[model samples]
Target: MHVPDGFLDAPTSVATGVVAAAGVGIALRRARAELDDRTAPMAGLVAAFVFAGQMINFPVGAGTSGHLLGGALAAVLVGPWTGALCISVVLLVQSLFMADGGLTALGTNITLMGLVGVVVGYAVFRLVLVVLPRKLGSVPVAAALGALVSVPAAATVFTLLFAIGGTADVSVGKVLAAMVGWHVVIGIGEAVVTGLVVSAVIASRPDLVHGARGLARRTALRTGEVAA
Candidate 1:
């Protein structure tokens, strides 16, 4: 979710900014391991796809709207660190150029969308893959499930943040319920988006997809490391 300006207090905002900066720096360093001639283009395409997908916001509740987080999709197609950077790049571009998210809340947005979303989603995905039959089809299915679960996870994180530093004195219970409820629906969209994107990348150039590349040649299943 793109947190608006004035949503969090100054101290919290600054703190989140520092966290976001550190995450970005770490991602920049780690993403080099994931990026290559083929993956570089794929990364660019994933970023653009995420950007365009975010532009189409869906009604969450009453009048509020939400968009595709795209972290799980990018992480599955690219790599987790690269996916975080890609999503952060999209958020930064949108915040600075389009003013979609508040400038002051950029750090908060990145923390929630880029770091939490990617990490949580990818973890869920890998776990699911470990449990399921490691077939080519399973990758997309796991991606879908991961994406579906991650939206509510992100919403839960946001609710916790709001409880800590929210300017408004809203009921924590209500906020959590509402946020999670709406995000469950939003997660369906995430599932579809993640599944489609992962499927596409796996179909065309499985080698380029960091998640899919771990699969063995015979079963298209991961041989080692659990497709992390």
Candidate 2:
């Protein structure tokens, strides 16, 4: 959901930049507590993976394309604070080097794809896991659903922003319908990939997955039972 320059009015864009800067600054400080030796390397890898993942864009109905935002994936692999930072970093690189997103609109992209995406996705994932049975497999399922929902939620947020500050004269209702409809399909792909990756990580190194901590505890208990 990269909003190109001129899509939003100048005042709106500048306002979003201010908000984005504040959010990123908070995230950087929060990341200091979340980052560690193990996660530091993994954070870079996650950023690279997100960067690569975004390259393979699926066509939307309006001739536009969308790709993995990777918020939920990053949050699951690392931690939420680091996940936000990683996505922001990837967005910044895409803006500067790839010219994929406009430099001036960088803050808008970060707010939608990085901050809002991660916050909503991670919160949903945690809530789902808490409601579901605390089995080892639940973690991946939760992550999958989180990834799925995050896309549309971000789209909805964009629609709201556009309604507030969009240059185009499109009806807010139509924009919301189009954005949410296309993102539903995107969310399906997100669910599949996120579930697979999270499950694989839990199988091999559950310790590495932030969302799999409960799963690890349950597995350890089962192993202890069998040993007994």
In the order shown, what is each candidate's alpha-carbon RMSD? 4.3, 3.6
lDDT tens digits by residue: candidate 1, 28-100:
9999999977679889998999999998887766887777899999898889999999999999999999988
- State how far residue 115 of model 2 sits from its true place (Å): 0.8
Q: lDDT of each model, Cα atoms only?
A: 0.88, 0.87
The alpha-carbon deviation from the true structure for residue 206 of candidate 1, after best TM-score superposition, in angstroms, is 1.8
**TM match of model 2 to true structure:** 0.91
> How big is the positional error of residue 1 in model 2, measured in Å on the Cα after superposition?
1.7
Count of backbone collisions within predicted model 1: 0
